[model samples]
Target: MKLRTWGFYFAEAWRGVVGNGLMSFASASTVALSLVALAAIVILGANLEHMTRMLEAQVQVVGYLKPDFDRRWSDLLVQKVRAIPHVTDVRFVTKEEALDRLRSELGPDSVLLQAAEDTSNPLPDTIEVWVDKPSQIPGVVRAMRESVTSLDSVDYQQEVVSRLAALTRAVRLAGAGFIALLLLAALFIIANTIRLTVFARRREIGIMKLVGATNGFIRWPFLLEGMLLGFVGSALAAAAAWAGYRWLAAQVALGLPFMPILRPDRVLLPLSEALVAFGVALGGAGSLLSLRRFLRV
Candidate 1:
């Protein structure tokens, strides 16, 4: 198309928005509200998954050796533990090292450390095993028991890890479904918005058809009008979401430093881009779908 024709289309689209001021405002507001909800869920689901991964990393199995277990066999026991299915890595801690860790955990000024320095360390040699996933902990622990007779005890946070894994799955499933519903509602709302525009301009459309204008020519302006609404609403939503998330992140950092919320920079940029894209696409699709019935003129 020539620059002149493009200019004409844009002018017509702008007129469509400006002529029906109330409907345009309603359309943009609806789109903005829908996208705001979508953005919140996306940010929340991403942080929840991040926290799940952090918790997964901390899950480990510790196997303590019998008091009489020979120190020479430590290397052999480590190799056997590493060979177990689902075991990703293994580290052996000597009795002395364990005692030193306990001492440090007790702090430099603690009376417990003073007493421990003069006495024999009662801590045992232990093997720490890491797995790729939380669910594999039980199998790995069972394997450790059957394959290594020197194990005086085997332990891991089985209940907590299990619950966390289940919760992550539920959140992902629920978040995805809710996001889809919100987008669908946004799509239909855009369609309704365009329907109102088409209804208002029905006489103009019939006249254009009578004058031998092609359907494509008639379609371009409405399409642009829909996209314009989408762009305006999405821009507002992005700005609002960005500002809100930034404030929330700062507040969380100051008040609950231990929470694993993602930084705004890590999440907001991509989230804003995605919201804009989804909003525009939905508007274009909704417009295209609604114009079909009106185009019969």
Candidate 2:
């Protein structure tokens, strides 16, 4: 299209928006609200996923050796555990080191160590196993149990691992469902708003058709109008989401310094861009759908 024609289309689109001010505002507000909700879910899901991964990375399988096990086999056992396919590293903690760790954990004045000092250390030698991935931990634990005959017990917190996996999956599924519902609601609202605009302009569209205006010509203005509405709403929503997320992140940092929260820069930029794109696409789609029946004339 020529520049003049494009300008005319945009001008008509602006007039449409101005003509139905209340409807346009409603449409835009709906889009904005939907996007805000979507952004919240995305941010929450990302943080939950991060926490899950952090927990997974910290998972370790510890195997305790038989109480009377000879010290001569410790080095060999460590080397063998390290050789396992998914095992990243294995370290043997001697009874002395274990006792020291207990004392440190118990604090400087704890008499628990003093009472045990005269007696042989009751703590068994332990093999600390680290895996390349959390998923490999179970297999590594099983392999260690089967291959190491001297192992008296193994501890990997199986229940915790299973619960974390289940929680992550549930969060992801719930997020997906909620996002889909919000998008659908936005689409319906925008489409209905554009339909109203089309209905109001039915006579003008018919007149244009009689005057040899192509369907494309009749469609462009409404499409642009819908896109403008979506753009405005999305911009507002993105701004709100960014500001809210930043404030929340600051509060979380202040309240829970040890918890790992996603930084705004890492999340907000991409989220803003996505919201903008979604808004434009949604607006265009709504306009296109609403214009079809009118264009059929």
Candidate 3:
């Protein structure tokens, strides 16, 4: 493809867009709306995935010891627990450390903290256990109870882990289906718009064929036109998505500072590039599909 040939394709594509301004606007607007929903889903899925990772990193099992439990076996117990499957390591939290933690949780002026300071600490020794994965919690907890004696209780956030896993799967599956539907609708509208443009230019197409122009030559301008339509829509969608996500992130930061969400600056650049590429691909696909029947001559 020479520069002049490319220039001609761009010129013709531009002419098509300008000649059928209403139809072009309709196609682009529909594409933008469809892509905006896709952007929302992508951003949401990203944040959910980030949160899941954070939780996974922090997830651990804690075992409380009975007050009468012997402290002499602490090192031996650590060794026995480390030998358990999926148990990475274990640590002993003495009553003093546990009291300090309690105070931290209850705050400096807390009545409970003042009383604990004045009276002998009744906080039990705690065993902090780390596992390789969240799924191993149940089995590991059971093993802990069986292997260790005078165990007060075994505690882990297995429910939280399970719920987050379920939610992430559901969001991704639903989002994927919805995105597919939106893309199909966008393709249908763009194809119809391109088909109309092709119909109006049928005479020119025939003349080009008569002059020995290849089907490729007749197709290039319409292909470019379709792509241009997608380009405009995707750009608009990306801009809107970036702005919306940035504002939402800021609001989340102010209202729910503990919540973990990706910064727009980190997320938007790649997201926008992906949307533009996806839009252009869809445009090319719509152009190809629409022209398949019309190119028989």
Estimate the overall C-alpha local distance difference test score of candidate 1.
0.85
lDDT of 3 by residue, 186-212 (tens): 998889888988988888888999999
All predictions: root-mean-square deviation over Cα?
Answer: 3.9, 4.4, 3.0
Model 2: per-residue Cα lDDT at residue 274: 96
Off by over 4 Å in 1: 64-76, 94-126, 147-153, 157-162
**Poorest stretch of ten by lDDT in candidate 1:** 50-59
Deviation in Å, model 1, residue 289 alpha carbon: 2.7
Model 2 quality (TM-score) = 0.79
- What local distance difference test score does each model get? 0.85, 0.86, 0.89
TM-score of every prediction relative to native? 0.80, 0.79, 0.87
lDDT of 2 at 212: 98
lDDT of 2 by residue, 1-297 (tens): 799999999998998898889989999998999899888888887887787677666638889999888999989998888888988878899989999998886766778887877688888899988888776778998899889999999998656756867876887788789878877877787788888878888888889999999989889999998899999889999999999999999999888876778899999999999999999999999898888776786
**The 10-residue segment with the lowest total lDDT in model 2:** 50-59
lDDT of 1 at 118: 67
Model 2 regions lying over 4 Å from their true place = 63-74, 92-127, 143-153, 157-161
> Rank by lDDT, descending?
3, 2, 1
Across residues 107-202, which tens digit of lDDT does each residue of candidate 1 receive?
A: 688887778776877778988889987778999999999999989998887676667667777877887887788777777777887888888888
